[model samples]
Target chain A: EAGVAQSPRYKIIEKRQSVAFWCNPISGHATLYWYQQILGQGPKLLIQFQNNGVVDDSQLPKDRFSAERLKGVDSTLKIQPAKLEDSAVYLCASSLEGGESAIYFGEGSWLTVV
Target chain B: AQSVAQPEDQVNVAEGNPLTVKCTYSVSGNPYLFWYVQYPNRGLQFLLKYITGDNLVKGSYGFEAEFNKSQTSFHLKKPSALVSDSALYFCAVRLYTGRRALTFGSGTRLQVQP
Candidate 1:
């Protein structure tokens, strides 16, 4: 089976610019997630989507980051007026709608704000 | 809140020797544990998960984990290490606050010397 797919494997933008990352989850998977992995730290959940509806986004920075899943299949995460601290990898993952199920991740979209 | 911990920042083992990466989790009830590996510049790949019925969960690439409820630990082990086994390993727990989410630990870097 094919795994999750993400675009723009790498991106570099000037500080205070805007950038967007896209994700397409595995087929038939009902749960999707977006995570930010900064260097020297673990992955932190930016948002989660259960069939196009948000499940959790408490850790997300509402002032600069936003995400959406359309039709429960594809997701897009956007960051506006990016900061140098925002330079990290954005990971997209999918699972079969349960906590017990293992989540498979894409290669990740690397972001660098200069 | 449920969480997992990888206390070691890095682990070093010689090739052909046994290896162990420690992980511990904290949660309210029965916990679901997972192990994932991340190569440099790559996303997380699922290695194994412990949901129910089995304390010893085996996963890809000759990796296995033993779940100890008494200790609240799920430690990843390999009988014999290889140079290619070097990577960053993460321990995660499945949580159900409102919806399912996976919370990961800081990660342990495994280095194998041939």
Candidate 2:
């Protein structure tokens, strides 16, 4: 089976610009997640989707960040008016289910805001 | 809510020596614990997980983790360190309440000397 896939391996943009990253989860996986990893910090959950419906987004910076998993297959994370703090790696992951199944991650999209 | 902690910023060990990376977690309910490794400029790769069965869980790359309910910890261990094993390791937790997202620790950088 193919693993999760991501596009645009690296991107550098000025602050206030907008950028988007795409993700394709493994086939038959029902859960998708977006995580932001800042330097020297853990990867933080930005949002979660269960077959196209959002399950969580409490940590997402709604004011500047947005994500959607349409058709329950592929996902896109967007950062508008990107802040300097938004510079980090965006990781996309998917799993068969919640607790017991294995979760797999993509290579991630690296972003830098200048 | 759930959270993870990697107490060590980094761990150093010589090749062929045993190595351990410490992790602890907090949650109101029972947790599903996991360990992941991230190489430079890459996404996280699953190492192992502890759901319910044995206290010791083993996974990819000869890596294993021990789950301790009393200690509220899941520590990643390797029988013999290799230079290729030098990378950042992250601890994560997710609840069984149907939400499939994960909360990750700050990460531990492991440096295996040749």
True contacts kept of each: 0.81, 0.83
**Which whole-number lDDT from 0 to 100 does residue B87 have in model 2?**
97
Tens digit of per-residue lDDT, candidate 2, span B77-106: 989999999999999998866675788999
Which candidate has the highest DockQ of all?
A: 2
Docking class of 2: medium
- The per-prediction CA RMSD against the true structure, in angstroms, equals 1.1, 1.0
Per-residue lDDT of B1-114 in model 1, one digit per residue for the tens? 899989999999999999999999999877888999999999999999998887999999999999999999999999999999999999999753346589999999999998
Candidate 2 chain A has its poorest 10 consecutive residues by lDDT at: A95-104
Q: Report every candidate's CA lDDT.
A: 0.94, 0.92
Write model 1 residue lDDT over A1-114, tens digit each, in one string: 889999999999999999999999999999999999999899999999999999899999999999999788999999998999999999999999777888999999999999
The best candidate in terms of lDDT: 1
Clashes of each: 0, 0
DockQ of candidate 2 (2 decimals): 0.80
